[model samples]
Target chain A: MTARIYITPKPDILDPQGKAVASALHDLGYQEVSEVRIGRFVTMELKGSGSPENRQRIEEMCRRLLANINVETFKIEISET
Target chain B: MTARIYITPKPDILDPQGKAVASALHDLGYQEVSEVRIGRFVTMELKGSGSPENRQRIEEMCRRLLANINVETFKIEISET
Candidate 1:
C-alpha cells in the first residue's frame, strides 16, 4: 500500500512562497492566475495493506510531525494497487 | 475556478528530504514506512471557468515553471467548485 499526504497552509495564514510564485507567474504572463498556495506532497510506501487502522496511524503521523496543526491542514489518501 | 497541481520527482530520482523525513518518522515509531518521496502541491485560483483550454494553459505552466521537466512529472486538476 501507498499513502499520499498533502499538507497545506490554513486559508488565513500568509504564504510567502506562494506569493513569490504568484508574482513570478504574473511576470511570465499567466495573468489569469489570481492566487496560489503552495503545500507539501508526500508519498510513502507502507508495509501492510490499506485498512482503517492504517488510516488512523497515518492521520496520527500527520498531526504529530507532517503538519503544523496550528497553521496547516492535511489530507491523506491510501490505496493498494 | 481552482486548480490543484501535484509535482513529483521522477521515480528514479534520489529524494534526500524524503529520506530524512522517513528516518524521523521511524524514530517516532512509524517503523512500517519503508520509503518516502516528497514533492510540491500547489493550489491556484483562476479567473476563468474550467475549460479544456484552461487545463492546457495550466499544463504549460507546469512544464515551464512549476515542474522541472528534466526530473519531475506533474498532474493537474481544475474544477469549478
Candidate 2:
C-alpha cells in the first residue's frame, strides 16, 4: 500500500514562494496566471494491506510530521501497488 | 480556470528530504513505511477558458520555470472554476 499526501497552505495564509513564482510567470509573459500557491506532495509506501485504522494513523503522522497544522492543510490518498 | 501542477524528482534520483522523512516516520513508529518521495504542488489560476493550446503553454512553463527537465517530472491538471 501507498500513502500519498498533499500539504498546502491555507487559503487565508500568505505564500511568498507562490507569489514569487506568479511574478516570475507574469514577467515571462504568462499574464493570465495568478494566485499561485505552492505546497508539498509526499508519497509513502506501507508494508502491508490496508487496515481501517491506517487512515487515522496516517492522519496522526500528518499532524505530527507531515503538515504544520497552523498554516497548512493536508489530504491523503491510499493505493495498492 | 485553475492549473494544479505536481512536480516530483525522477524515480532514479535520490531524494534526501524524503529519506529523512521516512527515517523520522520510522522513528516515530510508522515502521510499515518504506520507499518515500517528496515533491512540489503548485496551483495557478488562469484568466480564461481551457484551450488546447493552454496545455502546450503550461507544458512550456513547466519545462522552463516550473520544473527541472533533467531531474524532475511534472503532471498538470487544469480545472474550470
Candidate 3:
C-alpha cells in the first residue's frame, strides 16, 4: 500500500516561508497568485496490505508523528494499486 | 470548483528541507519515518465552473506560477462536488 500525506499550516497560523514564496511570486509577475501557503506532501510505501488494522495504525501514526497537533494539520490518502 | 495541487521536488533534486525534517522526525523517536520529503499541497477554490477549458487554464497557471519547471513537479486534482 502507498500512503500520501499532506501537512499544512492551520488557517490561523502564521507562515513566514509561505509569505516569502508569495512575495517572490509577486515579483515574478504572477499577480494572480494572491494566496499562497507552503505545505508538505509525504509519500510512503507501506509494507502491509490494506487491512482495517493497518489503516488504524496509519491514522495513529499521523496523529502521533506525521502531523503536529498544534499549528499544522494533515490529510492522508491511501492507494492499494 | 476546487483544485488540489501537489508540488514536490524531483527524485534527483536535492532537498535540504526534507533532510532537516527527517532528522527532526528521527529525533522525535519516529524510527519508521526513514524517508521524508517536504512538498507543497495547494488547495484553491477557483471561481469558474468546471470545464475542459477551465482545467486547461488552471494547468497553465500551475505551469506558469504554482510550480517551478526545473526542480519541482506538480499534479492537480479538481473537485466540483
Candidate 4:
C-alpha cells in the first residue's frame, strides 16, 4: 500500500516562507494569487494488507513522526495501488 | 474553488531534512519506517469557477511561484466547493 501525508502550518501561525512566496508572486505579476501557505508532502510505500488496522497505524505514523503537531497539522490519504 | 498543490523534492535529490526526520522517527521507535522525504503542501482557496482554464492558470502559479522547477516538482488537485 501507499500513503500520502500533507503537513501544513497551523492556520493561526505565521508562515514566513509562505509570506516570502506570496510576495514573490506579487512581484512576478500574478496579481490574482492572493495568499500562499507552504507545508510538507510526504509519500510513503508500506508493505501491509490494506485494512482498518493498517490505516490506524498510518495515522499514528503521521502523528508521531511525519508531523509536528505543535506548529503543523497533517492529513493522510492512503491507497492500495 | 480550492486547489491543493503538492511540491516534493526530485527523486534524485538528497534531502537532509528528511534524513533528520527519519533518524528522529528511529529514535522514537518507528523501526518499520525505512526512508523519509520531506516536501511541500500548498492549499489555496481560489475565487471564480473551477474550469480547465482556471486549472491551467493554477498550475502556472505552481510552476512560477509555488515550486522551484529546478529542484522540486508539483502536482495540483483542484476542487469546486
Best candidate, DockQ: 1
TM-score of chain A of each: 0.94, 0.95, 0.90, 0.92
Higher-DockQ candidate of 2 and 3:
2
Query: Number of the top candidate by lDDT?
Result: 1
Task: Find the 10 residues in a row with the least total lDDT in model 4 chain B.
Answer: B28-37
Q: Write the per-residue lDDT of candidate 4 for residues B1-81, one digit (tens) a residue.
A: 878888889999998998887787778766655677788888777677788888888888888767789999888887888
Q: Could you give the candidate ranking by TM-score, starting with the highest? A: 2, 1, 4, 3
RMSD of each: 1.0, 0.8, 3.6, 2.3
lDDT of each: 0.93, 0.91, 0.74, 0.80
* Tens-digit per-residue lDDT, A1-81, candidate 2: 988899999999999999999999999998888689999999888988667888788899999999999999999999877
iRMS of each prediction: 0.6, 0.8, 3.0, 1.9
Model 4 stretches astray by more than 4 angstroms: none
**TM-score of each prediction:** 0.96, 0.97, 0.70, 0.83
Two-way TM-score contest, 3 vs 4, winner: 4
Per-residue lDDT tens digits for candidate 2, residues B1-81, read 999899999999999999999999999999988988999999889888778898888889899999998999999999989
Residue pair clashes in candidate 2 = none
- Fnat of the models, one by one? 0.92, 0.89, 0.43, 0.49
Segments in model 2 whose C-alpha atoms lie over 4 Å from true places: none
- Output the number of the TM-score-best candidate: 2
Residues B1-81, model 3: lDDT tens digits:
767789888889988887876676567664554566667887665566668977876687678777897999998888884
Model 4 chain A: which ten-residue window has the lowest total lDDT? A28-37
Model 3's C-alpha root-mean-square deviation from the true structure amounts to 3.6
Q: Could you give candidate 3's per-residue lDDT for residues A1-81 as a string of tens digits?
A: 777888888999988887876676578664544566777788765567668877776677778777787988987787885
- DockQ of all models, two decimals each: 0.91, 0.89, 0.41, 0.56
| Deviation in Å, model 4, residue A36 alpha carbon | 1.9
